[model samples]
Target: MTAKHAFHLALLVVFMMVAPARAEDLRAVMEADNARWLAAYNANTPAAFPAMYAKDAVLLPPGSQPVNGNEAIGKFWEARLKPGDKKDHTFEIVSIHQDGKYAYQVARWTVVVVKDAGERTRFSGNTVRIFERQPDGGWLTKVHIFNADK
Candidate 1:
């Protein structure tokens, strides 16, 4: 093989090796974002979600109409976050893929709800989120959808 061809093949090999590392990095970032969201939810407030979403973001909750924009999404969360509810929430991230300015996550979530009446229930669901890379090196949720496990 020509020296130039060998060099090009080596470069291609290196680039191919780096792609998985980049995806791993993106997964870490997405997991951190999930942690922040869980922290806010555990605090019994929907304060973090709207801020994490883009201005024109869309939320599709199961059995409900589509929620458009941050304001509506904020309200949707507000209605669900109870003041004194005890809940243990977790995210099971299945995959994360990134391309240029966009990244998407396929994940599952489980929550254990404990009410004041000692009623306990466990709920699990699947979630998908699409995030857009901001100019400031941050990510904003461009689309979010959740479906309860049957």
Candidate 2:
């Protein structure tokens, strides 16, 4: 092979080796993020979430108006969530993929919400989260949408 062809072949081999590792890393990072997200939500700390998102992030929740921007999203959640509201929650990541500078995660989520008025309800649903790769090489949620299963 010519020098150029040899260089291209080596690059291809490197990519072949790196791609699987990237997939593994994505899964681990997504799992860690899921844990953080659930902890924040169950803690009733709406203020804790906006920083996990991009400045222009949007949150599309079920049976509610679309929440725009990181700040608005935080406020929207704050209005509905109270301390001791969430009794339990889980995020079961179904699939995750990264393309270039974006990664998307599909997860099955469940939560048991407890009301101060002595009401409890369990909800389970699916969520799709799109994360944008940041300049610091971290990921921030750019778009997050979740709906409860009827």
Which candidate number has the best lDDT? 1
**61-107: candidate 1 lDDT, tens digit per residue:** 99999999988898898899888888898999998899899999999
RMSD of 2: 2.9
Over the stretch 46-124, how does candidate 2's per-residue lDDT look in tens digits?
Answer: 8988888889998999987788898888888788777666568899989999999999999999998878787989999
| Candidate 1 Cα misplacement greater than 4 A, ranges | none
Off by over 4 Å in 2: 1-15, 115-119
The C-alpha local distance difference test score for the whole of candidate 1 amounts to 0.92
Error of 2 at 79 (Å): 1.3
Worst 10 residues of 2 by lDDT: 78-87
Against the unseen true structure, what C-alpha lDDT does each candidate score? 0.92, 0.90
